[model samples]
Target: MKILVTGANGFLGRNLVEQLRNQGYDELLLCDRNTSESELEQFSQEAEFVYHLAGVNRPKKETEFIKGNTEFTEKLLHLLNENPNNPAVMFASSVQAELSNPYGESKKKAESFVQAYGEKNQTPVAIYRFPNLFGKWCKPNYNSVIATFCHNIARDIPVQVNNTETELTVAYIDDVVKELISLLEKSSFNETSVLYEITPTYKVKLGELVNLINTFKESRNDLSVPQLNQNLTKKMYSTYLSYLPEDDFSYDLTMHVDDRGSFTEFIRTPDRGQLSVNISKPGIVKGNHWHHTKNEKFLVVSGQGVIRFRKIGSDNIIEYFVSERKLEVVDIPVGYTHNIENLGESNMVTLMWVNEPFDSQHPDTYYTEV
Candidate 1:
């Protein structure tokens, strides 16, 4: 199908167009601010569907709202009216349309035009009133607080909250794009519907939102992974990472080094325990310890190593030979003292996952010769 997308360079427009291309919709009429009138005329005639996403959200002059929004929408509909296809229209409106401001008034007017054109031509039409939206590629510090907060906080910039109790309804850009793509397919819902709402919107308070974003910044130093079980947090975390400065992609981890080698914590989770990397030099041995309630899995990824195990009070010793040539995991069972020794001429590197994070007060580990 030939789909025409206005504001094709915008956040939502870019996301929607990318998915369309991925889904094999090769015939796309991408109309940006610089698109010529003659080209738009040709696109309007050839398009089978129109995503009217072009609009002015934060124009410097208030008069530009009507020029970019209402007037432009009328012109597009006029061009499409002359075509034989009578293509379906999907209008992206805002919740602020209910207000009397200039931006809202312009959107309200554009919505009226789309509805009338659909009624007169008897073509598919839908008007979606979106709430605040956030995701990667959204510009920061304009109208979206979520984007602004995510961008500013990721860079250690101060964020101001006007009211602690201020609540916001936000939608993830991926969700919105998914919904829009579904609407374009032949299996659409209520083709002539005047109003449609997207699902899975998150409502968050200003104070709580600020606190959640702050924790993401603090996670680097604490080595604590933020909880992503919730959708809002998952989306916010993704958006936050996208706003990070290009030069700040990597972070330094604290490494405990000794004659044996170096041990560094890779990831720390509250419920999922911890992951660490252990490096041992040639002829070096590490991890002569036993745990009561803790368990671990060690995977040797480089060089050759030997793992030895013995019960706390037992004398029988069990040994397992491991090498980088054959990747394997050795589980450390409770009540068994364990140790890994480098058997190769080169250094041995292993990845370790423990059942719980290491706590100085309750280490749960007891050193023993294995």
Candidate 2:
């Protein structure tokens, strides 16, 4: 299908175009702010569908809002009406259009024009009043508060929040794009209401949002990962990572090295648990320790090893033979002293997951013989 997308370089336009191409759309008529009117007219004539995304939200002059939003939309509709083919139209309107501000007035006028054109020409149209949108490739320091916060916080710059208690309804860019695709496929709507609403939006407090973003920035040195079970935090963290500087994608972790081998912590979370890697040289043993409340699962990924565990007050010892030949997990129970001895000729690598992160202040660990 030939689809024309105005403001193709804008935040929503870029994401929509990229995803459309991924879904096997080849004939896309992309128009940005620099595209000439003559070119837009030609593209509109050839397009089977139109995504009218071009609009001015932040402009140098107030009057430019009407010119960019209302006047431009009027011209695009006029060109589409001249074409013999009546293509389906979709407009990226905003929830602010119901307000009395200049920007809102412009969007309101543009939305009215599109609806009128759709009724007169009998062309199908979809107008979306989006909330605060956030995702990758969004321009920082403009329009989107989430984008600005992510960019600034990642760079170690302080962010200023005037009303930290202010709440906002936000939508992820992927969700917006998915809804657009659905609109194209179904093209179903009620004649009474021309508005199209997207589902699964998230509501966040401004202060909480900033705090979550700050945690993402601090994860570099802390070797911690955010709690992804919360839907909003997961998406927010992903969006934050997308704005990181090119050279700062990776960070190194400190490995505790000794003659026996090395142990490195990879990730830690408050409630989810922690992951660490342990290396033991041949004939070397590590971890003659027992904990009061912590439990661990150890998986031998390389070489052969024997994990021996003994109850704190008992002489009975349980031995589990582990090797790279067969993957198996050994659990270290609470109040039990445990140790792993490398039995192979080469070094052994083990992946360990503990239910709780290690703390130096109150290290529940107590040294004992296994």
Candidate 3:
């Protein structure tokens, strides 16, 4: 099906268009400010679906809002009228439309026009009043506070929060695209107004948002991953990584080196657990310790090793020979003293996962021979 997307170069429009292409919709007529009127007229005649996303949010003059938002919308609707297909159109309106400000007024006017035209001509239309939208490609300092904070914090730049307690409702760009795509499956309008709300919005306070961004910045040194169980934190963390400077993508971790080998912590989460990489040189033995409450899983990723475990205060010793050739994982039970010894001619690498993040102050580990 032929689809026409306005504001094709814009933040939201760019994301939606790329996803549509990824989904195998190639017959797309993308119209931006540079596209000529005649081209838009031609696209309007052939398009089976229309995504009306073009609008002016930060205009120098008030009249530009009407011209960009209302006038452009009217022009698109009129052009769609000339075609016999009566394509399903989706308008990217804003939550600001509920207010009386200049930008809001223009968006509200455009929304009203779309709704009335859909009712009068029996055309299917979907109208969305979006809150602050954030994700990759959104212009920092111009559109979304989340984008601005993510970009600035990733770059070690300063960010200011005017009110710490100010709450913001935010919508991710992916969620918005998914919601718009879902509308295409409907056969007819179920509601009288043809207005629809985007689902799964995230609410965050200004100060808390700043704190989360800061933690993301410090994650490298702490080797901590932000808790992903929370929906907002997961979305925000993804957005944060996208804004990281290209040359500054990778961070260095200090490896503890000794005569035996090297140990490095990769990731730590407050509630989830910690992941580490352990390297044992040939003829070297490491990790002669027992944990009272913390449990661990060790996977031999490279070379060969023998993991020996002994129950505390017991005479029995259990041994598990592991090698990268077989790719096996050994579970280290709590209250058992364990040691991993390199059994091959080369260094052995093991990936370790624990149940809790390690604390220096109160490490649950006790040094004991296996």
> lDDT (0-100) at residue 142 of candidate 2?
93
Model 1 worst lDDT run, 10 consecutive residues: 184-193
Which is better, 1 or 3, measured by TM-score? 1
Per-model TM-score on C-alpha atoms: 0.97, 0.92, 0.96
User: Model 2 over residues 1-370: C-alpha lDDT tens digits?
Assistant: 8999999999999999999999999999999988997899899899888999989999999999999999999999999998788888999999999899999999999999999989988878889999999999999999999999999999988899999999999999998998887766643655677898878799998999999999998998898888888888899999999999999998899999999999999999889889999999999999899998999999999999999999989999999999999999999999999999999999999999999898899889999988
**Cα lDDT for residue 80, model 2?**
94
Which model is ahead, 2 or 3, in terms of TM-score? 3
lDDT of 1: 0.92
What is the per-residue lDDT of model 3 for residues 1-370, given as tens digits with 9 covering 90 to 100?
A: 8899999999999999999998888999999999999999999999988899999999999999999999999999999988888888899999999999999999999998898778777878888899988888998889788989999999889999889999999988899888776666656445566788877898899999999999999999898888888888988999999999999999898899998889999998888799999999998998899998999999999999899999999989999999999997799999899999998999999999999988899899999988
Q: Which stretches of candidate 1 lie over 4 Å from their true place?
A: none
TM-score: model 1 vs. ground truth: 0.97
Worst 10 residues of 2 by lDDT: 183-192
